[model samples]
Target: MKQDIHPDFKKVVFLDTSTGFKFLSGSTQGSDETIEWEDGNTYPLLKVEISSDSHPFYTGKQKLADAGGRIDKFKKKYNLD
Candidate 1:
């Protein structure tokens, strides 16, 4: 393996922007922002729109799509039985 050819994989804090949830994980992504974690250590801050903390599936609040309605609409649009 070549040296210095890979991205710097380090610990980064992923903040859920919507829910304000934060967690520490390793990533190769870089950020200009820094955040002091609960451990009193500063790490790169990566803001994400959604995370498992606030995701619909994880929270069990996902809305069931109206598949029947969509099928009926499609059939009507194309005049298919």
Candidate 2:
């Protein structure tokens, strides 16, 4: 509850560079760059490498390793099958 000791928290725009997605949210992070949002207002712009839109896990496009095949190969190699 101290005054003048906390970082400024304000609405900022986070840009996902990979998917070109933009969202407005509150953040304490600062940026020199500014962007015009859909609301016709300029806000601080922060560029990010990945976001939910382009992430494999969120989009259900992640490739899971074939553990069953690996186990079979290991069993064959060790003659445990």
For model 1, what is the alpha-carbon lDDT of residue 6?
Answer: 88
Q: What is the C-alpha lDDT profile of model 2 across 1-81, one tens digit per residue?
A: 879998889999999876678999999998999999999999999998778877898988863444338778988999997
For model 1, the run of ten residues with the poorest summed lDDT: 62-71
Model 2 clash number: 0
Quote each prediction's TM-score: 0.70, 0.70
lDDT of 1 by residue, 1-80 (tens): 88999888999999987677999999999899999999999999999877898789898886334433887899889999
Each candidate's clash count: 0, 0
Task: Return the lDDT, model 1, position 12.
Answer: 98
* Top candidate (lDDT): 1
The Cα RMSD of model 1 versus the native structure comes to 7.8
Candidate 2 residue pairs in clash (backbone atoms < 3 Å): none
Candidate 2 wrong stretches, greater than 4 Å: 62-81
- lDDT (Cα atoms) of all candidates against the true structure: 0.87, 0.86
